[model samples]
Target: MLPRNTVDTTVLPPGERFGMWLDLVARTSAPLRVESAHAADFAARADFTDLGAIQLVEYRYPSLDATRTRKLIRQSDPELYVLALTTSGIGTSSQDGRRSEILAGEFTFYDASRPHDVCHHANEPGRTRATSIITLIPHAALPLPPKRMAALYGGRMSGSEGLGALLAQFLIQVTGHPEQYHAVDAGRLGTVGLDLATTLLGRNLVAEDAVPTEVRRRALVTQVQAYVHRHLGDVTLAPRTVADAHHISLRTLHRLFEAENTTVAAYIRDLRLARCRRDLADPALRAQPVQVIAARWGFGDKAHFSRAFRAAYGMSPQACRDGAAVTARDVNDLASRVNSARAD
Candidate 1:
């Protein structure tokens, strides 16, 4: 796995929690003046992951207000661009004379070398905490001009659809399940993140035509794959539908997946089969009919699904489920025997 370290303020004495957090934030992130209502007994946690040229930090804390002033910048400037995506609660940011309210499922950009104000709070009742994932990218690493990037300072960006959704989902998945990725994936993941960020920014600025063709292509492929994964259960989902949704030609879509060394239909089929195979092995779904499980994954023809399952797993769906049941029974019987022996 990539190098990751977690810091929790709760581990320190209540009186020292906020101080330690402040220092830690200054070191891991940029220098800033930070305040919190829970300062006396601040409860916060953050995970910092190093991804080659970039870094990702996931934070969970109570209401906070932080300012990156000229003094702080003069004290230590990282010359980095920080993209703050709030996963929960609401927040506001100000930079370059622009202030924007960023709600949950939204993000904003700020430059560490410039002055900015950020506040994270929950406007809803009964919610006292806020969560966010921050991405730190060095200014030199970004290909866009500073003037163009400056226009986005403190601008609200939605993570609801298009490139924004893909980037948001990617960050969330990586932070939520770091164990799923390996150290070898760090550089590749970082490049993908940069590409997606560049594409999103370029699109918003109406300068996507200026982005490198290869970067745009990679970002589009990633978006298409995400879309396919999300609509796997839709029987109407096909290569043409995927192409249309992405506003690309069917031939172009085929070419994109070709670079991945797979056809669109084959990709969808493999994913559906994988889902069906997993469901068959799940004990909770044991009582469910095999056809129902297959149909749920867009496999309309029972015989076709059965044939596909057999070809993929070398076993019929019923046989796979029965095998899982036998294994489960064996484990349970062994456990019961061990308990009985201990009782005697």
Candidate 2:
């Protein structure tokens, strides 16, 4: 992510600022009629990031009116869903004959493919700028029904609580702290973003079942994986137990795992083995016996644990731990090494 542009109307001959703003907006977003005083005393800036499947843009600007007219719709209709999250501003919007009043800490959606009107005004004049996060989501990327969502356009939605709050929190974190995530994980983040958005819309409409099965499945898989990792020390963490915890049937849980090319039991075993591998290498746990280590990771039977550990690491747990003894954090300082690799 990088700063796309910074336009301070104050430096310009007042008259040229509004025209330049129009051109800039026309190139980045849809063409709209911008209404402001002739003084052109406004100032604005924007930053954009290309997050695979979605475009995230942060805008800081003064109060203005943006109107999308029929003529502009005829000029071009970019079928995109724009979500405007107001961070510090008071705004009003109208679409589909519905009007909504919004304040700071709120969000609303508008269809870029149709006509709409927006009025963004500042709450206090001395603020840095009326900032907002605008997410451009393609029509095909959203899993919820479009018409159903359209009915919600131009309505004030709470982003301060519930699922919408989670979505809002995630957006703020990802955009504000990009270093916390890996670049390779951008696509996954996008998927989660869409799922949260769909779930939020479904909840707002009081029709969660309308959310697509794929959307729900992906979301459930994410939640279940976290739950499993958190409770991996429990020997009773079996497929039936996991299914019950999630309020889903055992068959459905198994099917969800299968979609990821594994079974519920296998996923648990792999994670357990991973934890065991990490523990066996810990210098503080060197005095601990292999049986104790195995039990710590939920492997109850001694013989079964030994055989499974050998099958997974090509060596018994004891042998692996003996070879894993190290005094330093890096491999360059390691006294011995053992290849403990497994595919899941």
Q: lDDT of each model, Cα atoms only?
A: 0.89, 0.79
Clashing residue pairs found in predicted model 1: none
Please estimate how well model 1 matches the true structure, expressed as its whole-model Cα lDDT. 0.89
Tens digit per residue, CA lDDT, model 2, 222-308: 767867987898988999999998889999998898789999899999899888988998888888887788898899999998888
Q: Write down the TM-score of every candidate.
A: 0.88, 0.64
Task: For model 2, state the Cα shift of residue 211 in Å.
Answer: 1.8
Per-residue error (Å), model 1, residue 184:
4.5
Clashes of 2: 0
lDDT of 2: 0.79
Off by over 4 Å in 1: 1-3, 179-187, 326-344
Lowest lDDT 10-residue stretch of candidate 2: 335-344
